[model samples]
Target chain A: MSYHSAVLSGLGTYLPKQIVTNREVAERLGVSDEWIYKRTGISRRHRAAEGQATSDLAVLAGEAAFVSAGMRHVDAVIVATSTPDHISPATAPEVAARLGCAGAAAFDVGAVCSGFIYGLATATGLISAGIADSVLMIGADTFSTIVDPHDRATAIIFGDGAGAMVLRRGEATEPGALGPFDLGSGGEHSDLAAVRDGGSRHKRSTSPDHEGDYFRMNGREMYSHAVEWMTESSRKVLARTGWSLQDVDHLVAHQANARILATVAQRLGIAPDRCVISIEHTGNTVAASIPLALAHAARAARLRKNDRVLLTAFGAGLTWGSVAMTWPHLDPST
Target chain B: MSTILETATRILVDKFDASAEDVFPDAVLEDLLSDSLDWVEFAVAVGDEVGTRIRDEELTDVRTVADFVAVVEEKVGALK
Candidate 1:
């Protein structure tokens, strides 16, 4: 059987209109604005308006991706997110239906911040295996809904947004064709970042303490593990693609934090100029981080066609992954 | 100069850009390191230098540079 390459044909991102500045968060958390910026490298972030859900953001991003690809249809849709509109039915099916691609194979991929790359890997497989010729992949999250406003650690770091990409069956020689991927998980460290309640193990009602409903993260442990795992995984993908750190024109890492991005790039020997960061304005949009960063990079002209881009992410569930691809020209409207 | 204290101090200076004078035996690790990432990296560097695995739980009681030095010394001694 012949395998086809899954080429990233288009990209789009949607950030909610409500902006929350560091000053506002600092005043609420009783910290100086400079302290927040110095620690998280975030100046502002967007919050979804009331009545907005993960699926709403996903649908908008998916539509933009379709428009960017100049195609009206896709064979499958994958939504990568930790926050879904409903816990029962997956958000992808609703996202696909809303985008008018009803009945298309649609599902959700949950890997927290690493969701986008995992979704990309899944979409690539679907296309290569001849299960689908084209795929619409989206990473969306509304983390602010679950974040405890009183917790300075999480409230300041998380924002809500969505990003989507259109992938089509194409040739491996194409500039946008994705190269090899490296993915890994450490379940033992799952507690390093998670929401303790709302899941089967600890149902929301079972715990009287509402604090368990909010997201919690061991920031220090997460930082060390993130840098180590991302660096290791990035090196693996680069080796798989026969590309060196010097060959990467843009290191589009998950915008978890600016400090983490800098450390990972430093460890990988990738220069600061080669790193792509949109987190300063977007905050940590969880699963939406990478694609949103990519879209922002394209809009800023920092990412050009045929440039070698290295993508990596580490998030809750102790999940991390990396993918390499040469940037492709995208529609400006996307 | 090759004692565990001196070696640990050297690792801290190299890994965290701490001044040799500031990294005294009494200096608190929390004061010297701003965030958890710094502490984690410091622990890893110390472990690598001393040829011992430093567990996170072991660092709970470690406050000052002397405390960290003692932990490293204990682990290295166990390896011997």
Candidate 2:
């Protein structure tokens, strides 16, 4: 029997209006713009307005995708995010309700930067299992909500944004059909990128000055692990799909940082021109980055129909994943 | 046979582009590798050569080239 395939139908993204330049960040962090640029390759990034929640960004991106796909309802709404509107409830239901998909099977994927790939896997599994005909998979985050602004390492990197895709059931041979996925996690390295407290395992301190409330990353360790896993996962998925490094038209790895991207590409023996360098402007938007990069490529006319695209990401939860697929025909507005 | 120090120093020179002359037992690693990020990369390079992954905490006292080499030697000895 032929299995159902999750084919890409529509794509959309929402980046906050306010742009923060590296010069501004440099003034606060006591570093030169040239220093930050040479290291992170971020010139500027978007910042959400005060009081904007992660669910709000998700809703906007989901609505754009729903409108573009011309769907009034969907079978599932899977949001991939590290930051949620509330600690108690998942963010997907509120996003689904707001996007006029009130009854979809809604939940959140908490794999951080690798979240979009995980969401894709979840969506594809749902369609393959006949549990859903269509899925609105969103990768959204407002990392500014949790990052400490005064902290130089994180403040210069994270931005606020959301991106989404509408996936419909189709045949496996379709051009937009997603291929086999490789997902892996290393809990042993979880502390490399962690909040360290405020979760169930650690009680919330009564003091307002608690360090656990802010996101903290071990940049050195993160740099090494992300490169290691993203490259390895990409190779695994490519082998499963029977594609070579030369077959990859676009290497859309997680837009974590310029250096990490360069290192992974070098390790894979993939040419620099084959990579999608969306992190230059948006910084690292956490889970929202991969889809946002897709939209950026599509909008710039860099992505084309049936082009072999390789997606890989690694992030907190020590999670990493990769997906191999051909490019979809996205609308110009994407 | 190459000793652990010679193997580690060779990795620093070949894989990570460290100047061979600047590498010594008392040389400061920060000066040789440029920054803390480089320190981590150096650990990874040494770990790859040593056949084991180096933990970040394992290099806590590694300000000098000899200190990093000591860690690499320890990992190499364990591999036997």
Runs in model 1 deviating more than 4 A are A332-334, B1-19, B41-58, B67-80
DockQ of candidate 2 compared with the true complex = 0.40
Judged by TM-score, which candidate is best? Answer: 1
True contacts kept of each: 0.43, 0.43
Every model's DockQ = 0.41, 0.40
Q: Best candidate, DockQ-wise?
A: 1
- Give candidate 2's error at residue A186 in angstroms: 1.4
Superposed model 2: Cα runs more than 4 Å off: A332-334, B1-25, B42-61, B66-80
Instruction: Report the Cα lDDT for residue A295, model 1.
Output: 90
Q: Write the per-residue lDDT of candidate 2 for residues A1-334, one digit (tens) a residue.
A: 5679999888888999999999999999999999888778899999999999999889888888877776768999999998889886999998888888788799999999999999999999999999999999999999988888889879999999999999999987788899789999999988878786778877685356878888889888788788778878999998999988899999999999987887788778799998998998899999999989888888888899999999999999899999998887767233
Candidate 1 CA-lDDT value: 0.89
